[model samples]
Target: MTLPTPPRLTLTPEELRALTTLYTTDGAWTVEEGRRHCDRLDVLLAAGVLMPVQTLLGMMYQLSPQGRLQVFGTKDLAHSLRRQQDRAYLRLCLQHYGWTRTTPHTTRHLTNYLGGRQLIEVMTDGGPALVGGQMTSGGYRGLAIKEIGERLRSPALHDRFQVILFTPRPSMGQTAAAPFANFLTLIPLVPAGEPDIHYGVPTRAQYVPPPPPWDTDFEWDTPHITASMAVRLRRDDSPLPRSSVAILCEPRSARIARFKADLTMDLAIADTQLRRHYGLSAEDIEGVPFVDAVLRPMHANTSLEVQTAVYLRSATLAYRNDAALMHLVGVGEMRRHLNVVYPSQWTVSTAGRHRIEEPDALWHRGAFDVAVEYDTGEYKLHHVLRKLDGFASRGLRGPVWGVPSARRAAFLQGEVGSRLMEPPLVTQWWLPETPFMV
Candidate 1:
């Protein structure tokens, strides 16, 4: 079944006058003034001259300048203001006042109304167009609408608008072959532009990356524990999804002195847990006088400072990988690598194992291994750190490493003059031959 169309909301003449007055006034109104305005509105509503109180209030809220409408009513009514349906209704009312309405599915009507030079110019004129909460900054909207206007100005571009509307099946995952049951003409105004482009409407769908391998190592489990603790300590409340974690481990002989100082003081686990697991009490974990004396310094002194540098090196590599992934996927994947790698006796061997290699390699061999056998997580972490160190130590003077980009290749070839050629023109409109619409 199709979704129900929202009702059209309008205000009576008296209610409109009140709204106008409110807009014109400054500072909080006295109780008497508020009561008088409410009484006038109530009288009109009683006589069927004004819309329902809720509808009227919703419209008023939308019309008010940002942060100004919250002072209008009782606490009970204020609570309902947060609802999305209320916000949508308010938007509908504003749209009715500002622009004439057509059937929701009428792409032709919308295009005819919005496509005209006069209307496009006006919309792009940096005027207030009621978008939900606060009025959008005209400059921002103008830039967007201007791009649209530029596209529509060209007949070649005008033909490119491909509007499609469909009730996407909830069960079907994103694929190359899913057919949309309904379609509408979409006008490509801005077209696709860098850094990224978003067209059509937004939806609330979770992006699930391809499934993990059957024998995926659980090394990710440790990073998750550490990351959760870090997030808790920082009091970060962001709702962004978590993807992968990078762990940087620095293994040193346990006899090294000043090793604890190199680690983050706020351990992921409490001293009690550390003591319970390692046979060292809280005092011993904290390096109390007696306990500190018992743990002998190594013949070769290794400072916490040295350990931290190694960990930072590893973390930086992890960051590079993250940046690369984000470049490929519009969304940034979670970087779960540990900021500090701790010394541990744990070891794993993969003398003859096979597994998928690089992230990109997955698409090619379906699976491939860089080496015959290695501790996948530890090896990757160490390799990335070592590569970063090499780049830094060599002053990046010679051949650059990692997945080389066109930009990098140009930079390295001493073709600086040729690389500074004029920027390519961005086509804002679509040609008639193209399959997709804006």
Candidate 2:
């Protein structure tokens, strides 16, 4: 039997405050936190707002996904550990080999660079790409510059292959004054990891009948030679197939602080074959969070923007080879890449300021114009209502409002949904690669 869900939630002001507080928090709350809301917990749970888990530290409460959507306008947790750039990039790799290729059967260690750490090689079509892993991300403050040099200085990497190191980044715009990130790449003269190059006389085959130009292959570069040594010795000939390299460093951001709330997630691999072959768990596929140390974080009005970009790239690439999805997004005369479109793209530019009004995303190509606005439920409700009102007043099919949760949808419907001649579509903010052609 289904419990009847009320069309409108009738909550005390304290309950609303608790919901807002939990929604914005990066970590979970202890049962001690339950004290203040003790009386109201049952009500919120019945309404699908508060989800209390009996943690090792006693009972803790986290906002339910639906409640988060209702509050934030989307279910995507702001503190999701999966959103790290390096990890996300690796996810892109798993979606397709072009992004990266990992070989668990032949795991290798990097001398000087990866130190004692052993990670599966990250490969590319052109050649060897990068070997990425976590570096010390000692919170946001300790993670600035000092942490990287000690890690980045392998002094032993190839010229063509980069020594890729990843760490959790400080918040956006935090490192403008920080120096250019030090890094290197090397494509070996021989097949990657096959170090045939040696300190040799000019008579050797490597320099035998030198080309019109000297065989650049045997330049005897310091980085390359050292890289060869690592490649020569990097292998873990041990028969055990443990997919471990201390997978991911915990980011100190308060947002994802409680990732360890689930201990079983540790020691997991994202590759299915690796797990089955290695006799590991099918329970989880958590990837390592690793990206170039040089990269920086940006404002997250769009942490989803980064995710969006990756999703679009992956989806479009699939359409190219997969017959069933060839015209999945219908990128006809319009640009295939994502670029911000302006009032000029719309035929009805005569609307003045409304044309200047910003859209979170737009699907415009001749009559297929649908401008979208994403509300995380972060803005003042009135401001959102006013923005939507002005947008709808323009009288196009959209200016679709991409909301996060059900309550937000209800609120929009209760308020703006009825106010406009054609209020924009209020749906979950999980955008498709393309603005879904509604």
Candidate 3:
């Protein structure tokens, strides 16, 4: 008789130690280093646990997020540890709402807990969301719905259950979950003393088409790479020594479009004067705005801008460190630079369709990578910090806020800084009294 196959082997302590080494260290591992650095490298490499990342140094291996979780046996050590407080608050909310843990099965689709015979699927997010991928309402909705159906298959658990989708902050306008509120519950998972959470579908129309493109004067022989393409090239050209966050404020959509168009015109005019001084060619001058895609009309929002600013600042910091020179990356240039970095963070379904989160600008110099948020005195301190926390999760340090008034800037720095490990930097930008007419 054929003997039953033995259970797959568990990872040896030696293998786990090797994985911990790769997980704790940053940068790619060379083939020679991989073989010699740790005894289990060959085992992990054969197990498809190490992923290849192409760097300036060459091909190197690093433990993928999944690989790390596999060897570590728990997610507590992952970068997700950054949001532990938020997750704890989410648990508090569930406890407050009377949800209880009744079952303890370790299945892949393990139900979080049970409440009076109803199975609950809980999706928790502590970062900016609603645009897609992992943290959005849509992503959680799909998972919860699928799990609900699976649980209903058990005759003991019926359709009396509800899925709780918890986010530390609300969506951009409190409208992202309107379309599906009937099917699920969406709630902000903040602690007491913060703003009272509101739960109404926004009235604004859902699908806003982008404004028309601007007309241009010059047509060069070579077509410019799209802004998205340019940003990706910069990211690949130099990976940051460490991940970072940059902050910046964004005005309304109309103002955002006008600023980009004006920057393109101003840059072209200034380049004409400085071309000879800098000994640059026509191709070089033309390529500047082309790379930025400032001439292209696109929508921008504050949320996405925050993500972009972090990336642009990080890229600038990396470049400055390597070249010993600074580059002039302005408002419009920063917007274009975000195209590559922010899209990946977006949910897969919304990635191509959504506009870049708009920001006024970003700055990166050595250890001073900062997101320059332009505060219009509109955001609540807690709401603003929630957005910043999203950036911090990606490896940013501190926000350098640009407030319209000194009094408000001081208030923000004091109130917001007390909560953070390092105080936020504040600066005052004297915004124009009225919108600048074209």
Candidate 4:
């Protein structure tokens, strides 16, 4: 939100203080005394008999704190006496008409004796003449007389009086000023008993706005992390296992060595038995097609390190999909750095087909292709078996073997990992150096 610029003022704090003191102290002088003081100061020097100083003093008294005149020095006595006389005249008129004057001024005693019984008749009968003649061309005093007439005539008003007085009007001038009757006669001089009128004026603060309510539940300091994170990280030690093994059964990293070794050992044993039975030398069977078939199992035990790297990259991508680091190193960059290598022999036969019996198990079978497809129909049964075993070792369930009923049932019900390395309808070849299994 934009803020307003602070206000600039020419007056210094000291000067403002002096001005305030002068206004408050000298402002309480009688109207005539205030006028004379203005005349001497060469201020408020208007041409009329009633000086503007009187107007200024009257306004200050009504508007300032406490709404009462302040005490000026001895030189201000004459002006004070003149103002007292005017107030006295008004009080005399009020008391003479049998209208209550709460505090009659000292100067009003003589007029009270003369006009005491005649004021009501004079005011009632001469309402129009008093209002129009006195109010139309008269100054501040004239307006006061007019207002008194209006209040007396108003049917809605109760506790009516002949006159009401306001020491200093709220605003000055013909248009802005409150009507004398309204300020002086209409508003009641409410007794001190009512809490609102202890000082004979409205109790509301003039210009201040009401303050905002307190916010008891507001917090200045909130916890940084969310509750879910707190719960997930609440362990006393390491949250994950010390070491993990991930397998990628692609052509580059397949466990072919162990399979080949096992197959070679089995083949050698079978060949020895066969040769012994048939009385044939090992060299005689060297170029047989069965020998090459036996060697196929060796490809099963490939490089575990390369496969682990690929799986680690895939896991990272899956886990840190929304991390800032992932964005910093773009997804394409990450894929290049950690490529997923699957066995070349394991082709996706039915790339987009859904299984009729196990439709809901598609994700578990690795059948749902996110970026690459994995299916059994287009791949050899032996290749699928190897891939399934590799995936199972790495905490994943492999795809279902889609073959004829008997063959598929045999494949599913067989020792899944062992059969993948078992020779088929051909004698297996051998490799000596590689381990039989990982």
Candidate 5:
């Protein structure tokens, strides 16, 4: 009952031009470009090569995965496609925590004392602020309370701006917390969410403390405190079950944007580390994108990377335990490896056309690797069986799944493997401890 998919042909110059126009313009084909390349664009649309995404700027055209692969060639396309996905993922996560980016990221030059370097500035629902610089080899040094106080004392500006920090430790520890509790807020970007697997080890569960009592009489001076007050007063008292650490963190608008940026960097570094650990050199990883190449099957079919990026935060929190040696391999890498070794069976037509055959993720731990397919309540038993069957044919063992609940975990093990361990939930690292805001 299956029809053979047509051979994916190389992109002609005209086709490549169309894809480039969309790609370079950040997936937005201005009306002028559209008119000039209308014929080619039309062809692409008919062939399901371009996906139209509507934005405030007007209509934008994004290359479908097939379009990217065919036009840019997988090598070059991987970087562009993964970056596109990363930005989209960051924006969505920011929105989830109530931040609507008010302005496009802008760069401002600071004085020589700060090295005259360009700093990235972002405006959100909270306020206009300067984003922290990218993490360096020394790791992220959080924005200090004294630094904010100094900026407040700056003669050029008065006390008008807020300093948002993107550090793993979102809270100013007890020593600093009490003093600057009203001055600044710490929002943890724990990627814990309802669908995350945070229960692998009992100790891995980030303790969720009882909600802080809303104080009507308390003075709310800083934006952070004010925002926390609003959220606490607005929500119901009933506690929700713990999952991703993000659940415990306050969802301030600024926190959301900062979290988005911070986690994006963390995931990027994790991919590089995994690749190098697995013996992949920089030359070997040239065109392979981070999420697509390393975080592959997880980010391929669904928005799992964007949704559970905080999972890395949880994984890091548990690194002292079993997750220390864990690494996530992308499905593209697996496919490429399979094709290079057995091109007759794993060519583009056969491997690229089918998602069922593609494992959601390749979980590598020492010598025992498992092909993973996440069960987010979207697949039936037959669907899962087929994925397992496909992996088996490739001399692979499982699409070792990470289910959402204990009940589902039990069912899967009964049907899959008895030794399978439950994936950990995405719990916050600073659980049971109140952040600056709440």
Candidate 6:
């Protein structure tokens, strides 16, 4: 009978690290030279992956030919050294850039020895780089580190850059506004006086981005897991983490939905957002329990969070179009930032039987309290009329319907204008002209 092909063996991270350190020596390394070497060298030595030689200069360790064969499956130390060196250089490159591409020159070198795993590409300011060659597992697995496709709310899950790398140890300088940072922006890395000295990354970055939002991780949907993997995610058959209902029900996500100029809040990260971040298969955007619960809440209070999300999403669209708030004020960069008071902050109704109507939001535009409604276009005609009638009772001005687009705005205008004699004070998709302009 023919023997099955022997499973190709590969080096563990520790072993690989030790071998790379040893490979740097011209012959043998004195113990003194091994001071900053990997601590796993002893493990490698015990395994006969390296042997000590008694030389005129005292004792030194050298990788034995037998050790080379055992460790690398090849006796050619030079060849294996080159591979390790390439892996290190490439890994360091990926670390520094967060994402980078190989040039045609480097690609020519890597293409010949190429082997691969799940293909990943890095997009830099330079361009997308297809890192060709043996992409070993461990430090480089899962998603390719890049900043795009990331959700940027407060309690951010990713910084501007995502890199699979060893934590860089760099000395920090004084935390003050330094005018020198302008010149630093043109320079990318450091020159530590080594191989790529002026080429490789420095101990400190010349240009540092502003501090990112607070970082956070997700509570994945791994349910019914045994003690084995349950502990892996800090769970013991607990129902809360995977329960989208529980997640969306929390106040944090809703609070985040209502935002300002540089909107910062946390995530009740939707299923689609999470999947897109990891490059998982595209699925429905309205995540389970999240959308259903948001759309079909048991009560008004239950739907508050969903409304808050819509409120923000619509606000963002308006902000982009420079939307007018109740035709009183504009919302965008060149214009003034809106100081919004959300529904939860509404004062209780004092009039007998006056069902305390709360519009989606009220934009305090210095001289005006412009009432705003974030319409999802799902409201029934009666529901829409009821909401409008409630706003009409407020008696200061007509309400602003923050619809999805100009088409929706026009449609809403036609619907409401035909019924109400006053019509909407302004039916506009773009930001409002100040009430003074009105």
TM-score-best of 3 and 6: 3
- How would you order the candidates by lDDT, starting with the best? 5, 3, 2, 6, 4, 1
lDDT of 1 at 286: 24
Alpha-carbon shift of residue 187 in model 6 (angstroms): 60
Per-model TM against the reference? 0.18, 0.24, 0.23, 0.14, 0.26, 0.21
> lDDT tens string, model 6, 71-150?
55665413232233224434444545565555564332322211342223455453432342221211221122221112
Least lDDT summed over 10 consecutive residues: which range in candidate 3? 302-311
lDDT of 2: 0.34
What does candidate 2 score on TM?
0.24
Query: Model 1 off-target regions past 4 Å?
Result: 1-99, 103-143, 154-333, 336-438
Model 3 lDDT per residue over 107-173, tens place = 2233433323233343234211111111112123334434533443342233333344554444532
**Highest lDDT: which candidate?**
5
Give the CA lDDT, 0 to 100, for residue 374 in model 3.
Answer: 41
lDDT tens string, model 5, 14-74?
Answer: 7687677666543334334455665666666656566553221223355665666676655
- Candidate 4: residue 42 lDDT (0-100): 24
- Candidates ranked, most accurate by TM-score first: 5, 2, 3, 6, 1, 4
Give the per-residue lDDT of model 1 (tens digit) for 36-56.
665564443333322221111
Runs in model 6 deviating more than 4 A are 1-356, 366-368, 418-438
CA lDDT of each candidate? 0.23, 0.34, 0.34, 0.25, 0.37, 0.33
Weakest ten-residue segment in model 1 by summed lDDT:
290-299
lDDT of 1 at 165: 13
Whole-model lDDT, model 1? 0.23
